[model samples]
Target chain A: MIRIANGQGFWGDSVDAPGRLVEEGPLDYLTLDYLAEVTMSIMQKLRRRDPAAGYATDFVDLVKTLLPRLVEKNIRVVANAGGVNPQSCRAALRAVARAAGFGGLKIGVVSGDDIFDRLGEILDAGCPLANMEDGRPLSEVSERVLSANVYLSSYPIAEALAGGAQIVLTGRSTDPGLVLGPMIHEFGWERQDWDRLAGGTVAGHIVECGAQCSGGNFTRWWEVEGWDHLGYPVVEADPDGSFIVTKHEGTGGMVTEETIAEQLVYEMGNPRRYVTPDVVADFTSVHLERCGPDRVRVSGARGAPPTDTYKVSISYLDGFKAVGQVTIAGPHAIAKARVCAEALWGRLRRAGFTYQETLTELVGLDSCHGTIPQPPSHLNEVVLRVGVKDRDRAKVDRFGKEIAPLVTSGPPGVTGFAGGRPKATEVVSFWPALIPKELVRTTVTVEKAAG
Target chain B: MRRVPLSRIAHARSGDKGTGSNVGLIAADDRGYEILLARATAEKVKAHFGGIVRGVVERYEAPNLRALNFILHDSLGGGGSASLRTDAQGKTHALALLMMEIEIPDDYQTPYPEGSPSKGPPAEGLSAPRRKSR
Candidate 1:
């Protein structure tokens, strides 16, 4: 069995979790997932400002901290921290390794997931590049498109591992691919091994969120112990397409069948068809059993062939938005909060600065779950949060200025506006499209750090 | 029959999918699964959400996990970075769903009994006051 642990759930996950996984356990591979749907756009913006500033810099520091141990333990690392630029990420890692005295470190770079520059050529070649959700053509927002990347399969990562690279960095690969890649390389699983691929995919999904399946954000929060030091998940995958989800011994958090079940259905669409670039996994066919404390054995994952196309995540400049909030205290907090919101909007409208979209929420009352008919009587305080989105940055900015004035001008007992006026931030919207699998070609290259 | 909140026999997790959000409800036992299968229909879930979910609610069943997943379309004001609401990702929709009350037999055994510490104190004024039968 090969032990693979996912430490980072997203771009801004716990920094200490990855190092903790290496220090606390016997692990063969450490996988870190850094890219989210909208992360590429942010990276693209950064690259435009400074060429070397795009990739996840946190990863460089992480490798620098764990380089000596990683070499000694022979633990291979796989991560999609490349963002929009895997080569730059690899260069940064090489510099870190050389500085840390691990000059012989081999880092593999996976490219071709990013298709931002080739958007026009691909679109003109009869691929409409239409939005998957609304069926809108790319022409509508093509000019505003900042970054476009295809979600590559696990094959590129496996190729990197097979080529003897100790660390593999990829751009825009699927989150689960980070785990499944090591499973394929260690077990020598064939390309058409549908059942095993599905099993590995299921295992990847369970632990993709790091500690989500190991007590973090669990529904039964009271049952899980040791919130201060929760354990990130590790998958003991075998050749026969079954795996055990467990954390390091004596670690915080509990791994039960229920925790596994909750993560199984997380962000799931059709249970019978969980599609990835590698294979179509049947989440309904998965079987979970509690083997021991902090261990859940998962098996019976069935699979079918994947689709002919790969889903591409594209982001564009939608508009600008700003949100501002103020606390309303005293006996009629909810009522006063409502008045504050209405007056702010009234002021904005009178200035002829109507926005494309606006939202007013009484946070302590029903902002989250919507307007519940009977909010508790005699609430002490409610935060009045007002937000506005518009194509015009000035309009969104004007809406922000109205929020703080409510303290002295609008209502009684208005405070907590110490942050001053909110500034308009660019709204980077997601546009998902499908590209023919053959259209996107991925390549893997391995290089050693120069002394 | 006695009416109790669904939290007595189930747990849930929710996250965003585009402009929509998915809530996966897992039962405590086979008996609770049966109760969920019967009572947790798409129509009822849509009605329970009120104006929060502006679009349709689609439900999918996974008996292997004793879970039912509901997809709430067009629910997040716009979802992701485009959304103006605080809970743009619909993260709290799971607990909001657990707040739904259901009817079960008086002798039904719940994993979380009414006064059990695991169930914790009842949420303030979530449910209507019980009326004494004449």
Candidate 2:
């Protein structure tokens, strides 16, 4: 059996968590997940500004911090911090490792998930790239697209491990792919081993969010202890594809059936067919029980081969958007907030700029659940949040300028304006679609840093 | 029949995809599941959400787990980075569903061992308890 732990759930997760994972206990492979759909466009924009600035710089720095411990323990790392540019991320890590005297470090860089430049060609070649939400073709928003990536599987990552890479980095890999890759490399699991592959996918799904399975953001938050030092999750895999979910010994996170169950159904749809590039994992087939304190045993996962197409996350520059808010307090809070919003919209329109979309909400009173069935009479304060989105940047920008005047011109009891005017920002939207398996190819190259 | 919020007997979790969102409501036990199967239909869920959801609602029954999954199309204004709302991903959407008042048969007892709504909605300032991740 091998022990795998996920330290970083997302790119912006606490940096200290990874170091804590290393210092706390024994781990064979440590995985980190970094990319989100819109993050691809953000990284692409950075790359456009500077070729070397696309990937997560925090990860590069963390590697420098972890080099000594990683070398002493011989622990391999798998991370998808590559964002839109795995090659650049590999170079940055190589430079850092070479300087830090880790000359023998064998780094694996996986690429080809990025298809930003080739999207136009693909669309021109009869690929509709239809939006998964609606059947609209990608061509409608093709000109505004920023970055396009195909979610890759575990094959390239496993190949990297087989090539003796101590650290594997990939661009746009599936979250569970980071875990599935190590399992494949360690146990030599075949592509056709659908059940085991399914098991591995489930294992990855549980730990992919790091501290989530380890007692963070649990629904029954009152039952969980050690909130100050929440430990990330680790999975123990056997030859039969079953695994035990646990955190490091003596760590501060609870691993109970409830916690595991919560993570099992999170951000999922159609429980029976949780599709990935690897296999179709049956979320309902899996069994969960509290085997021990801070430990849960997971087994009996069913699986099937994946579909013929690969899901692509395409991000585009939708439009410009801006939101600004001010607090209105003392009697008639909801009414006053609404009045402030109406005044702001009037000001924006009078300036000869109408937005494509506008939204107004009394945040404290009815923002989340929609219009309240009944409003409390004693309500004291509420924030007035108003926003606008438009293809014309000037309109969104002009909308931001209308907030502060509401304090004096519109309603009374208006406060909460510590920050300057909210500025217009580009809104990057996601367009998820699929392409045939034959249209994309992934490659992994393993090499040592040159001093 | 007495009217009470669904949270009296069930727990829920929600998430988003593009403009859509899904809520998974799990009954506390066998009795709760039977009650849920009878009352928590897709049309009812759509009605509960009303204008908050912009498209059709789809339901999947998980009898083995005593859970019902409801997909609310166009639930998120635009979802993810595209959405301008505070809860763009609909992380708190399940709580909104839990606040729904439902009809129960006479002599119905909540399966939840903790403080449950045998009478009406959960107390004010009471957060819809459960977990959110992913």
Candidate 3:
């Protein structure tokens, strides 16, 4: 049996969680998932600006805080904080470990997802980096691309673990890979163990967000107890691939059927066809039971083979956009908000500030559902959120200027327009495409820094 | 791009509020999504193109459904000026479709992977020393 704990849910999760995880209990492995889809692009921008700035600096700080306990507790660490730059990320972590006087920490890095340098080569090879949506090519806004990373799986992570590294870092791997990698390590689970791999993937999904499964974002949040000190999730895994999902006892948050259901529903697609880099888990086969306080036994996950091509996360230039809002109050507030929206768009059109797309909605009034939903008859107050998007920066900028004028010109019940003119913000877009796994090679290397 | 599991975000019905709706741009990862908050309009725009393209932008809302698939159609802009598609072009189209933005927490930082040397000694009592044989 392996006691695995998820310390950090994302890059910016609670700073003290990782350290607390090691200090508080018996944990075999400490896994952190920092990379998100958009995070890769941001990291790319940072890497371009400063060679060493691309990795998760927070991870270094967290490592610095937890190194002693990590070493003392025999807690192995794994994370995909590598974003677009794994080598740089590893070097930063090495520096942090050295500063802590812990020389020779075996840190492993998994990379090769950053295909930026080979963009043209791949295109020349006929990959066409076409937009999964509109079929647009990258040449449209290639210059504006801040970052490009392919979704990698747990194979590299397993290699790193097998290579005897104490800490393993990765660029853009699937979230489940973080948890699945460790399971692969302890149980010697083979890559072809589809059922076992799927089990790990399901377990990873359950604990990916730490406390989220333990009731962090419950809609019936009021019913939850001790949320202030919510306990992160822990996975007790067996060689058979079945695991128990629970949180540290004496911690805040509720581990009930409702909470589990909420998380189960999160990011879920086809209950039977949930695909990841490792396996396609079937949620329908999953069975959950509350065996004890804060302990939910999760088992019985089914899975199948993964897609031949890895889905890539591509973010490029979309368009410029800006939004501004105002609260409408007093008699016929809904009416006033609608008028404000119409007037704002009308005014923009009259000013020749036609955006490729423009929108105006009254938060509490109009159903805001594409069509002007019938506002509640008694809605005396509503927030008019108006925004626009266009390939032209000037148009979006102009859209921002129009919002403030509405407070004085559009209608009587306008008020929430505190943040001056909505600034023209660059639109970072997403492109999901498929690439043969062979085309994206992941390399795992372990390094030891001098103290 | 983060794909919002339809089951999770099916409850996310934002259009009723006004002119634009909060469409979840599901990515392979959650990389720039936080920044998407400030750039929500881009996500919204991407959502608008979901139906027009030949493909699909997965969006499903059912009690039994677990994820939303925003099946994107042909918004990749007809493969751009060159018939050949570059990785950048695909990513650009994904971003172009974004319309709604949500603010990521201020503490958000990007994480990356690193390579470590193999000659390091093991910790005193925690894990066993590196095994030479597999």
Candidate 1, clashing residue pairs? none
DockQ of every candidate: 0.59, 0.33, 0.03
Docking class of 3: incorrect
| Superposition error at A451 for model 1 (Å) | 7.2
TM-score for each model: 0.97, 0.94, 0.75
Q: Give per-residue CA lDDT, model 3, range A98-181, as digits (tens).
A: 888877789999888888888778878778776664578777777776667887888888888888788999888888888899
Error (Å) of candidate 1 at residue A428 is: 1.3
lDDT of 2 by residue, A1-451 (tens): 9989999888898788888889999889999988877778899999999998789888899999998899899889999989888899999999999999888899999998998888877887788999987789998998898999999999899999999999999999899999999999999999999999999999999999899888887655656778888889999988778999999887787998767776777677888999999999988888886788788989988899899989999999988888888999987887787788777777777878777888887887778888535555546788888888888887787788888888789778999965888888999998899988788878889999773
lDDT, ranked from best to worst = 1, 2, 3
Who wins the TM-score comparison? 1
Q: Return the top candidate by DockQ.
A: 1
Give the C-alpha lDDT of model 2: 0.85
Residues B21-62, model 3: lDDT tens digits: 222233212444333333334345445444323343444322
Reference-based lDDT, residue B101, model 1: 87
| Winner of 1 and 3 under lDDT | 1
Between prediction 1 and prediction 3, the one with superior TM-score is: 1
